[model samples]
Target: MIDVTMTRAYEMMVILYALSIVLYFIDYFYKQAKIRRTAFWIVSIVWVMQTVFFLLYIMEMKRFPVLTLIEGVYFYAWLLITISIILHCIARVDLPVFFINILGFIFVTIHLFAPDQVQNPLGESAVSEMLIIHISFAILSYATFTLTFVFSVLYLILYKILKKKKFSKLWSRLPSLQQISMWINSSILIGNPLFFISILLGLEWAFMTLEGLSVIDAKIIGSFIIFVIYLIILVLHRKGKLSGLNYSWANIYTFLLVVINFFLGSKLSNFHLWY
Candidate 1:
């Protein structure tokens, strides 16, 4: 029963993916200067198609699929795809189309193969629109930090390549080190205050949604740990200790917490494990 609508959406996504891959391949193997441009326009169209299906699912289900494990993974796939395409359009990095294509394929596989089911929320209190807004902003901020982590990994790889004095193929695919560094910094600059607001709103939501003012769930504690870690980083960054390996490692730690929350700790984690 789930497959009926889900499969239809999947088919649309696969079609878009197929087009994107073909366009990327054309842009790569052919080396036609205009091919990448065309590929981008095509990817944009595909994004519109996905938007339709993504919204359709949400509307039909009457809840955000992105709140669950399977749906969250799927959303990550969509996010990465969108990020890669948008960055390509704006930055024009020499990143190998190969890796990008491979990533696309991998996400597609997960989207197609992963389970699909309506994951219900835990408590039934009608959260305020502001609370949902807080969650959205928090999730977007989370996504930015996640992207920053990816960029840090890219920087490290590029650093290694430069140290060995070999321009590995990946170097071509990535933005310049200076540019990537700035991206990481600016992203955090934006994420920090948004994160702070998110935490404040989260506290209010907890009080409003739950029965008491002091109910500390395991999830609450887990989230607090992350919140504190990030808060420390932001403060230190203000004092200027956020650079080099220290920066990368901090991102790495945050990324791990993100994975836990997005996967194992999300509402649908257990269901995904058993589905």
Candidate 2:
């Protein structure tokens, strides 16, 4: 009965953790104070539950719970949650808190489904959940880059129309070139880090979960190439060497590469059979 209760509590904690992550993501995008407060409360509850479990483990084993791989993972997750709460409350930084909680969620999931922790029938499902998260991050980054591309295209169009002195209702409705350029930069700033994080998570998952997965897989290579290109573009823009038309065109071309990599590279990869 004790074991069953513990398992159910663990499951509930995981669910709340996931829900808090989703809420944080929404708060990040929407900037809703209510959502942020709710997420904070939920995360606080998760932290309390984690603390309870940590104490229980220490009492049961008569030692700190950091000696083994599973215990260390749980402790690491707890630390992440603790730091995230500090950042959320004191620092009030949205992005760092969100990303830290993402890492915390990953570690928490790792602890929950680790074979040594318990005989969990959902072990395979946990692996699938990780895969889904990896893919979701990649897709979110890609979508952000696509937004950058659209803004770049609009910039070009507006630039051309102004250059040709074509004054119309569309000219009044379209955002200025500077505004579009700012959007382009903002999108890349957000998307690039997300892409980098996704790549790290993908490689970690592939190495730990999949057998005989190659680092040279087409999808992996393509992802790295895309990441590098964006990094370079960002650097160039920061140095003021790439801007205006060149910057816009660079984003457009990079997005085309992203499209190809996402489809063709996936098809070519041996282990990336799942779309």
lDDT of each: 0.65, 0.79
- lDDT per residue for candidate 1 within 19-59, as digits (tens), equals 76776776665566786777767667766676676788789
The residue pairs in collision within model 2 are none
> TM-scores for all candidates?
0.75, 0.55
* Model 1 superposed RMSD (Cα): 4.4
Candidate 2 lDDT, tens digit per residue, 137-173?
6756865686677678778888898999996753454
Best by TM-score: 1
Stretches of candidate 1 above 4 Å error?
Answer: 1-6, 18-35, 62-67, 94-111, 122-131, 168-170, 212-215, 234-240, 264-275
